[model samples]
Target: MSTLSIRDLVVSVETEAGAKEILHGVNMDISSNETHAIMGPNGSGKSTLAYALAGHPKYTIDSGSVTLDGEDLVEMSVDERAKAGLFLAMQYPVEVPGVTVTNFLRASKTAIDGEAPKLRTWTKDLSQAMKDLRIDPEFAARNVNEGFSGGEKKRHEILQLELLKPKFAVLDETDSGLDVDALRIVSEGVNRAKETTDIGVLLITHYTRILRYIKPDHVHVLVKGKVAEEGGPELAQRLEDEGYDRFLVNA
Candidate 1:
């Protein structure tokens, strides 16, 4: 089974104030079919961890290691990380001015698989996947995330997740700007991807609303760049009611 193991990961970021550490020895392991949630207050370095995992170049790994199914991701480039079955759906997906959604998706698939998928099969699958996500058929011709609403962009992220079928996905604040309806739909798409591909999820969010739809096997509360608490689904409910005040206070 595919597995991702992060051990004592210490990350730093360059700021106007110079290099400052964000993540402080984060330790976690996730295998296929498992859902792990990282919840914390704003500026708690939650998004930093997500970006670090995806090798964004901004976050530097000062110490520790990240391994996927025994391969060292800490030594891999961004695209190398993706080829190793790692995926990150950004909170704000950037627009590709001239690349149509169709071309982008197919190109991404080809990159991941090292060979182009049969055009006929990919076409059918893409159509069905969009329909399932309730996306407009005409969207295939539009540039990626171009002219799309917040909810549409979020759904597009899921579409990539569903199509790419990565072994692990780090969804960073995917619910940030989504409404109730859009949240439900995106959450359902995540569940579908999990069930269909047994993909491990490292869901990072500040609110528990997304947890209401995508149940997590493990919930970790990141406080001041460290895990202050961790529990099952019940912990998420507690976080919803009590907020991160208790953790922050104790920290």
Candidate 2:
């Protein structure tokens, strides 16, 4: 089993007026077979944390280190980090005009795993995953997120997670903009992935609705780029009742 560790991680972005820090010495660890929920309001650097962890170029690491199973992740490129067993499902999944779902999934799998899957077995696996996620087989022929609804896009992300089978996944606000039915389907997909792969998940969200379905192992309240409070599932309930006011003050 692999573990993702972040220690005293500080991230900054280049601006017209020098560097602007977004994350402030954040620290956390996620292990295989565990799920961690990061809850915070807008502009609290939740997305920045996701991007930074995924090795996005725009976010500069000012200090500290990110490692996976004792391997240094900060020294790797985005593709390298992905090959090292990290995945990020973006909050806003992009529309790639000419790429079909099948091609994209195959390419991503090849890049991360260093070997192409056999066509016959790959198709069967893809079909089963799509069915589990309640995605239509026709979607495999369509362009990636080109005309997908919010929930469809989210499901597509989960489909990638299922097919890629990464060691750790950071879902960046995937519950956002999804309708109730869509939310349930998406949540079910996530649950299925966790069950099948023993994958570690860092679910980033602002509300507790998704938590109700996924049942996080740990819930953390992130305020002003820091984790202000950490606890079990009950912490998500308290945040739902009290909002971030208490945590914001403490942060």
| Candidate that would win on lDDT | 1
- Residue-level lDDT tens digits of model 1 in 1-251: 89999999999999999999999999999999999999999989999999999999889999999999999999999999999999999988999899999999999999999999999999999998899899999999999888999999999999999999999999999999999999999999999999999999999999999999999999999999998989999999998888988888888
Q: Which 10 consecutive residues of model 2 have the lowest summed lDDT?
A: 242-251
- Give TM per candidate: 0.99, 0.97
User: So what's the TM-score on candidate 1?
Assistant: 0.99
Clashes of each: 0, 0
Q: Model 2, 128-163: lDDT tens per residue?
A: 999988999999999999999998999999999999
Per-residue error at 49 for model 1, in Å? 0.7
Question: What is the lDDT for 73 in model 2?
Answer: 95
